[model samples]
Target: MHDQARHGGAYIRIHVTKQGFDPLTQRLRWSDLEQVLDTGPFPDEGPTTDDPILDGVSYSFQVTAPGRTGRHIVYAVWRAGHADQNYYMCSDVRFPGGAPDPTTPPPSPPAPNDGCTAAYTPPGQWTGVSRAR
Candidate 1:
């Protein structure tokens, strides 16, 4: 990702590779891309893949980032040529911290809780079953 600190904007570069025969030159279309910050959704208008994408080449396009420092999610989708095959990618990025370390394991799940609670019970029929206690 290219950090445009001066312009207060950023861009992401994607490298695509194909194993088999290369397809004819076709326009690359970006279906959708969304950035969700801690505050709310941040929208960005990126470039279209009009350039001929040769095998094993990199493509870069402008992207938007949140101003505040916090974890963010970027959802992106694109399609090549006129094929029905659609490519989808999601990225979990953090401002000021950058991307998470791949070596580190993901955080564990939160502890489970029962659905029923004292607040849900009637006033007269107190179960006296305080889960906290």
Candidate 2:
């Protein structure tokens, strides 16, 4: 999903709900995951601006489901300035290729100690703010 601040700018953080993780009932730490982008105080107003600074910037990242598949949730938390207020949104996505066949047994969950971490590396540098048309 694509979004931008309409009034005061904000610092954005991205987080994904792990396959077995329950974001509704469980407490989530927004700082633990890697941030996809930090727009600082003035992010490009998406495609609405005539000469958007980050118009061409594209973000990509990989997610691991760990024996689970179907749909997952991604959260974007935008914290405006340094105030105590925080804004958040959720996007539900389905994995490619749809669900596994019913005849096929589901994969076993990994052992408690078997876990891995994935990091996102930005593909290009941000060119900072530009005059909005």
Candidate 3:
């Protein structure tokens, strides 16, 4: 997630549910929501102040899925410390249980100097997404 305006610290709340999100209504079926998977406050990597003109930050989390699972949706809400607004994102994930398959290898690490900047100007866009460089 990209904080374009360099807003101060923020809190991230993640909830997992079997409920699927509706694109037409822009809502999620909360009936299957049992509990929140994880929550964390951000700007943990550094301090935030109004001094700098631009402050961009990113955060990531590793959450454990339920043992018995088929398909699930993870919702993340980002609430800025100084703002009353909240941003939302939903991700669909699946867990197929059985023996682990060796054919599908683990995810590889991000390449060095991939153009992800922590502060200041926006980092370069994802490679090969656009025609213009």
The prediction achieving the highest TM-score against the true structure is 3
For candidate 3, what's the RMSD?
Answer: 15.8
Q: What's the CA RMSD for each of the models? A: 19.0, 23.1, 15.8
lDDT of 3 by residue, 1-133 (tens): 5565655446777777743432222445666554564454565354344645656555556766465345567777778767787888888666674333357655655568977778454577555577655
For each candidate in turn, the TM-score is 0.32, 0.38, 0.49
1-133: candidate 1 lDDT, tens digit per residue: 2112111123222322211111122222233222332212122323333444422233455554535343444555443333344455655445464344457655555657877556476675668655553
Please identify model 3 stretches exceeding 4 Å from their true place: 8-10, 18-27, 38-40, 44-55, 98-133
> How many residue pairs in model 3 have overlapping backbones?
0
Report the Cα lDDT for candidate 1.
0.37
Pairs with backbone N, CA or C atoms under 3 Å apart (clashes), candidate 1: 28-49
Global lDDT scores for all candidate models: 0.37, 0.52, 0.59
Sort the candidates on lDDT, descending order: 3, 2, 1
**Minimal lDDT window, size 10, model 2:** 54-63
